[model samples]
Each structure stands twice: as structure tokens, then as C-alpha cells.
Target: MVTVKMLKPYYVKTEEKYIRIILAYQYFSIIMNKKVYQFIPVKSTEVRINRKTKKIENIDDVFAFQKGKEVLTISMSQLVSIPGFLEMLHRIAESYYLPEDTEAVSDQQRALDQLISELEYENVRRLIDKAIDNGDKEAFLELTNTLNDK
Candidate 1:
């Protein structure tokens, strides 16, 4: 049977709070995606877990690297194993930001909005003209609201 051997506490600090996760694995691999970490070349870091429990240990030594960019260690025990890992990988693969979805946006709409934003004089007047021509009530209301806001 696989058991989680008690290790040191892992900490994560955010803007609002500091979270400590108790790591129980003696050995682990940090799996990273190219899209997520961005530019950092490590795909995985093989960590050698130290079992010494008497003294306060430096965070760097227990983790993977010696000098360069440190790998962010997420305990393998914290992650669900086998089928779950496969499922997570599948989800990441299917994500919207995976380059394929970016091409789906139509070029015509992008160019029109780009042109509209670049125009210096009375752009809203042009929009109002178009809205009036089309009899678009929603566009008219939005225009009125924007005018009121200014």
C-alpha cells in the first residue's frame, strides 16, 4: 500500500492570504505546462526529499534546484493519482487558450473595431449615424448612456 510519509509544511503566499500545505511525500515530480509557466524551460523537477526532522531546513535544499530558477513543488500526494492526472492533462489540452481558438475570431470584425478606435474626430457621431440608419434601439440607448456618463 502507498502511504504518505510526513514531510515539511509547504507554503503559498497570495495577495490576500498565506496558505501552508503539509507535504507528506519523500519524493515528487513537479509537472509544468509550457502555456502556464511561460518561458521557463523546466518540464519537471525530480526532488530528493530529506527525512531529517530535528531542525529548520532551508526551503531551497529540500526543493529541486541548487542555484537557477527553482521549481515550484506541488506534492504528488496532494494531487490525485492515475486517472485523475490523465483527466487533468486532458482538460489542459482542451483549454481555450491553446492557440487554435485565437484564429476563430473573424478578421472583418477585428479590422472594423480597429478602424473605429483609430478614428480621431466625432467617432460616436459616426456610430450614431450608423445606428440611426439601422434603427438600432440598443445602440441608441448605449450611446445616450455613454453621453450621460461623460
Candidate 2:
């Protein structure tokens, strides 16, 4: 086992800490008495976009935590080699998405409305549009307000 010390002076002001474990190999040794354990440590980088002062944060200033604590790990390799790998992982996480979301649901509802009779559908059409306009679902309140206005 190897021990690494802090590269810079800092204070541990809080009692919270994070932990992550990764297994490098799964095969068991048949001839030897022990199994190999490889450990890795990850360095966190922060990201912030500012519009007022427009001051961007240094990547090193960001940190990742899990379960309400800052994460730390033991690695089998040098600490200097870990940042680049962590940055790549961050980039990949930033690019993922679910293409069909809530916007698509509203669009589908609009298309289905076309199949109903225009004369009979006018009240429903008005109610749905009023709901969207007021950002509220109380169709009866909107109808009452509309009737009172005239």
C-alpha cells in the first residue's frame, strides 16, 4: 500500500467525505493465496457560467460529492494522470439527453384536437388555450372570468 500526502495546505472544515469503489479485475487466483485489488482516486473540477461579472471559475476549483460528502479514493496510479480522464468523463455526461420530452407531449395533444368537430370543440379549444395562457388548469374559473368580462 502507498500513502499520498496533500500537495497544498488546506483546512478540513467539515466532517463530510465521499467514497467510490471500482473493481479492476474479477478473476480469482487458483494458485496464490490472495486477490489483486487496484484503487483509483478522482479529482473534481467545477463549472460555472456567469453573465454579470463574466468571471469563469478555474477547473480545479470544482469538486464532486456523493451522499452529501466530498468524494476521495485510493488509486494504483499517479495522481497527475487522473484529471484528464475525469475531464473526459465530464464532457460525456454533459452531452447526453432524452430527445422526446414534455414539448412533444403538448404538440401531440394539439394534433389530436383537429379530429374533433370545430363547432362542438370551440369551448374545449378555448379552455385549453386559456389554461396555457394563464399557466393554470382551472378551466371553470377562466370561463367564469370570460363570461363576467362581457
Candidate 3:
């Protein structure tokens, strides 16, 4: 009488060691007896994934959160019973580990580096103009020296 409706990470945080995925309404949903139910975490609902292996390392249940003090917890047992919960989590792990994302990040960083270089050059040019207009020989010589060193 139960069927999985949907399962996906609502929010994902990537770290140096692992990736943490949060499950909540719309993030993890199921249907039981024709009634849809969404999981809400009491204190912790983070699913920790191993970055290297792309496998789920931990799914923290309510009991694991701060000694299980809070109420309004999702049933971890029921979550496991969802038709494709584990499989979907694995798929998300794989998607997040794609090499293309790394390439895109590097490209963005290169763009930023170019922008910074252009701004520095513009600033130096303005300073050189100011030195010449003010007849400041010392500053003009220093500016030329600095540009040459670069």
C-alpha cells in the first residue's frame, strides 16, 4: 500500500571530506494508502555521502540527533522501505561527482583572474597620468620601474 513518489536532495552541501544532503518536504516524498507524506527532520536529517567512492556513508536518524531530544521525527524505517530511495541517493551522488563541474569552476576562476589583471593595469595607468600632470618626476620614474618589473 506504499509507493515512492519522489526522492531528491532538497539542499546539498559539499565539503572537503564529504557531501551532506538534507531531506524534507518535496525532497523526500512517499505515498501510502493514496495519501502523500513528506519527511521532516526533528533535529538532524542529513545524509552524508563519501566524495571519493560516491556512496552513502551515513543517514542520520532522529535518534542520532542530539540524543533524540526533539519530537516530530521522520520514521527512518519507513524511509528505507520507499521503492527507489537508496538508488536515487546513489544517482545524486554520481551526479554531484561529475568532472565537468570541476572544469566549470576552473574556468570561472580564470575569468576572475583576467578581470583582476585588467583592473590593476587600469589603476596603474591612472596613477601614471596623475604623476605626469602634477610634474612629479619621482612618482613617474617609480611607476615606470614597477611596470617594467611586472
lDDT of 3 by residue, 22-136 (tens): 7665566566556666655555577787776776665445512111243234445555556777677777777566354678899999999999988988888889999999999
Q: Is candidate 1 or candidate 2 better by lDDT?
A: 1
Worst 10 residues of 1 by lDDT: 11-20
- Model 1 off-target regions past 4 Å? 1-121
Question: Which window of ten consecutive residues has the lowest lDDT sum in model 2?
Answer: 23-32
Q: Write the per-residue lDDT of candidate 1 for residues 1-150, one digit (tens) a residue.
A: 222222222322122121223322332223344212111213322222222221112234323211134445333343334234434323332322223234446676798777776673367767877888999989978876765564
Q: How close is candidate 3 to the true structure, as a TM-score?
A: 0.47
Off by over 4 Å in 2: 1-39, 42-99, 117-150
Ranked by lDDT, top first? 3, 1, 2
lDDT of 2 by residue, 49-71 (tens): 22222222233332322222523
Leading candidate by lDDT = 3
Candidate 1, TM-score vs. the true structure? Answer: 0.20
